[model samples]
Target: MRVDLFDFDLPADRIALRPASPRDSARMLVVRPDGLADRTMLDLADALRPGDCLVFNDTRVIPAQLEGRRGDAKIGATLHKREGPRDWRAFIRNAKRLRDGDSVDFGAGVSAIASDRGEDGSWRLSFDGDEPVELLLERAGRMPLPPYLAGKRPTDARDAEDYQTMFARKAGAVAAPTASLHFTPRLMERLAAAGIGHETLTLHVGAGTFLPVKADDTDDHRMHAEWGRIDAATAERLNAVKARGGRLIAAGTTSLRLLESAARADGTIAPFEGDTAIFITPGYRFRAIDGLVTNFHLPKSTLFMLVSALMGLETMQAVYAHAIAAQYRFYSYGDGSLLLPA
Candidate 1:
């Protein structure tokens, strides 16, 4: 199918510039077979049923944005995928101008020598560091802001909080599992009181989630691989929930993708730890999840396609139109939606 079928228009104003105060106060759009309803994150407890398994991605977003000059090229950098501790695939702002053997100097103690450039203008930039990637990135990197935030740069204030989910523990993602951002500790307690069960897995979301679907034919698009892991204990908990016949609801597309990737043919799950390039588009059969709690995504982006994959193309289009008309915030730090597969 043509990827253009998934495209929609979003006003610049609809892109959320800041997170909702108190986080959980953000608007919620619940989608059922009938239609969509506007609500708030406080309604989550009521929306979820008892024994429903809510899978969460606990991968924390890092301060991956780096500003440095490579020769005369003023390039903005985001460490997208890590090939090794020192080798990274970065998306440079002005990638067309740079070629191999060009040196991109990061701030003090950190400099990247460009080794090669890949298709789609991504560069294989090697860092000049002996320390681990986490340490190097933390020292010189800025918070990797979403593209929607114009003229806004990360500071020490927003740096600590802006791109993080409440339940983050593991670190690797360049993007936050944004749906988790709407949750607060109090809200989680309420969910527990309501008997809505939840579990977490780590899918260090790469920059790939933000990539637009350039493929006219959806099948032609090759997905970027990201690292993920599920331990034995989490697997046991998930299995127990499924054995009780509870509906599996994913917190975001990251958790949903990992769940689908870990699912066995017999409808069972196992401990999974590795990389996955699992790209879910429309018409794909889902094995593990029945519902999704997510945020509105950018038009023509992979996230929109993922949501459309869970629901239907027509349903997502209508739902998104409603969101746009209602002035619901979109993208990271945006309002959320709950969708069940149709």
Candidate 2:
């Protein structure tokens, strides 16, 4: 399909710079086959059946954005994937100034050597210290905010807490699973009280999520891989939910992709651990999830394509048109949508 088919006009003012106070106060646009309705995140539990399970991504966002210098050239790095304990694959901002074996000083005693550039143009950066790389990042790195927000303003101390979800535990992701950002402990308690159970999986969201689709056609676009994990116990529980006629609702595209990747042809989810580069487009069959709760996505983005696949392209196009006209916030720090297909 033509990538241009997914394009839509979004006013710049609609981009949210900060989250709604109390998180759950954010508005949610419910998109069902029948019609669209407006609701707050606090009303999420009421939007779904009691037997449904909301799947969340537990991958914690690391401080992966770094600024450094090699000789006189300024360089910026956003670590996307972990290659080893001390090695990470990062997208560089000043590639032409650096080469294989060139060392970059990220300041605050953190430095790394660049090597083995990938076809995507990202470089492998091996940290110099024997100390854990996490510690190095703590001293030198900033939260990797989505470019849409970061380009408008600067990342600050507030982002250290706002960018992460309450379920964050396993630290690896360069980006937060923003859909879960609307969830608060109060919301969790409310959901449990409503008998809407929840579970967690991990998908270390990379900076690739922010990359634009420059391809003219959907077939020409390539998705960068992100590491994810689903253990046996979680898989078994998820399968049991399906068996009992319960719906599995993914709280984010990260969770949705991992669930679909782990789904067998027969639609049972299996234990999985590794990288998934699943590029969900229109005409793709969804086996694992019944619905999705996700943020408003960029025009012509893979995320938009995934949502279009979930609920036909025409439906989502109308949904976005409604969202835009309604003045709903957009992007990572933006409002959300609850999409339930017929």
Candidate 3:
């Protein structure tokens, strides 16, 4: 398939610079076999059927964006993964200029020495401090907003809360699991009243999420690894939900990917902890995640391709065009959609 198959034109204004006023007040564009339907984020409870189970990625977004001056060069960096107490894997701007032995001085007096290049293009950084890197992140880091967001920078204040989900408490991810941001406490109450169930899982969003798909054909695209875990109790709950004839609805791509990665062909979910780099594409068999709630993704990106795999490619593009024509918000803090296989 041509990489362009997943591409679509998006207007500049559609990219959301900030989240909706009331987080769950964001719009929702429902794409079904019949056609595209417009709705609001709060309508999700009404849109989904009873006995459907929701699997949410509870991984919290860390304030991972930081500015550092290495030598005379001022560079922006995002912590991708933790390599150790003082060591980390990070993506830096102007990688060509940053060489080995360079040191980064993060604001609030924290500093790190570039140690080595990791598996991909990211670097290993060993910090020079007694304060845990998490503390430094709280003081020096900003939300690791996507590059596409324009107008104002991430420090605009509202992003600090808007970029996170209502259920966000655990701290690790560089970005919020966007879909989960749509559910309000009221929405959760509605789902519960209808007998819908939800379980939480963790998959810390990383720099891998920001990687542009470079493969000429998606089959050749290598997945970026992300650390995630499925606890025994949650696994048992998922199995019980399935046995009770509930449909599995993954709240975001991250959660869906984690579930698929840990699922057995027999539909059993087990306690799992470690790194996962499962890449979903067209023709891939989905062992888990029968339905998905997610936001519109960037054109020509792996996320767009993943949704294309879940729904047909043609339908995915068509739905996107409809969303654009209808003026729906896009990206991190944008509108959401619920999808079932074609």
Candidate 4:
């Protein structure tokens, strides 16, 4: 399909600069088969039946945004994927100024050598110290906020906590699974009381998630690979949820993509690990997840295409039109939508 089909005009003011205070207070646009309804994140537990499970991504956002200099040239890097313990693949802001085997100093004693440029224009950055790379980032890096938000304002101390979700544990993701940001301890307690169980998997969401679809057609777009994991125990439990007639709703596209990547043609999921470059578009059939809870996405973005697939193109188009008309926030720090297909 032409990428233009997904295009929609969004007002600049609709972008959310900060998350809603008391996270669960954020509004949620529920898109069911029957119609749309405006609700708060707190109403999530009551939105579904008791046996339904909301799958969450446990991957933590790393402080991967770095600004440094190589000689007299200024450079910026956003580490998107881990290649090794000390090596990461990063998108460079000043690509023309960098080359293979040149060390870039990122300040606070952190430095890396740039090498092996990828077709996508990202470079491999191997840290210079014997100390863990995570430590190096702690001294020199800032949270990798989505470009849409960062372009409007600078990242600050508040983002160190706000960009991370409560379920975050395994640290590697450059981007937070923002839909999960709306969840809070109080919300979890309510979900438990309502018998709406939740489970977790890890998908190290990369910066490519924010990349624009410059392609004229969906087939021309390339999705960047992101590491994810689903152990046998978790897979078994998720399968059991489906076997018992319980719905498995993904809390974010990260979770949903990982689930779809692990699902077999028979609709059962298997233990999975490593990278997934799954590009979900319209006409794709979903096998693992029954519903999705995700943030409002960018125009002509792969995420919007995925939602269009989950529901229908027309349905999601209507959904976004309604979301925009209702003044729901947009993008990573924005409000969320619950999509349940017929």
lDDT by residue for model 1 (1-342), tens: 788888888988898888898899999999998777789998998987899988999988888888888777787788888887788888888777677888887776788888667876788878885888788888888777666663454455674686799889987788889999999998888999999988889999988777767778888998899999999999888888889988889999899999999998866678999999998888888988889999999887778888888888888999999999999999888999889765
lDDT of 4: 0.95
Root-mean-square deviation of each candidate, in angstroms?
Answer: 1.9, 0.6, 1.6, 0.7
> Candidate 2 lDDT, tens digit per residue, 55-135?
999999999999999999999999999999899999999899999999999999999999999999999999997999999
| The candidate that achieves the highest lDDT relative to the unseen native structure | 2
Question: Positional deviation of 59 in candidate 4, in angstroms?
Answer: 0.4
Ranked by lDDT from best down, the candidates are 2, 4, 1, 3
Q: Runs in model 1 with CA error above 4 Å? A: 150-156
Off by over 4 Å in 3: 150-154
Candidate 4: residue 33 lDDT (0-100): 89
- lDDT agreement with native, every candidate: 0.85, 0.96, 0.85, 0.95
Best of the two (2, 4) by lDDT: 2
lDDT of 3 by residue, 14-80 (tens): 9887777787888988777778779997887787788889999888888888888877888778898
Name the candidate, 2 or 3, with the larger lDDT value: 2
The TM-score, computed over Cα atoms with residue i paired to residue i, of candidate 1 is 0.94
Number of the candidate with higher lDDT, 1 or 4: 4
Residue 283 lDDT, candidate 3, scale 0-100: 79
lDDT of 1 at 3: 80
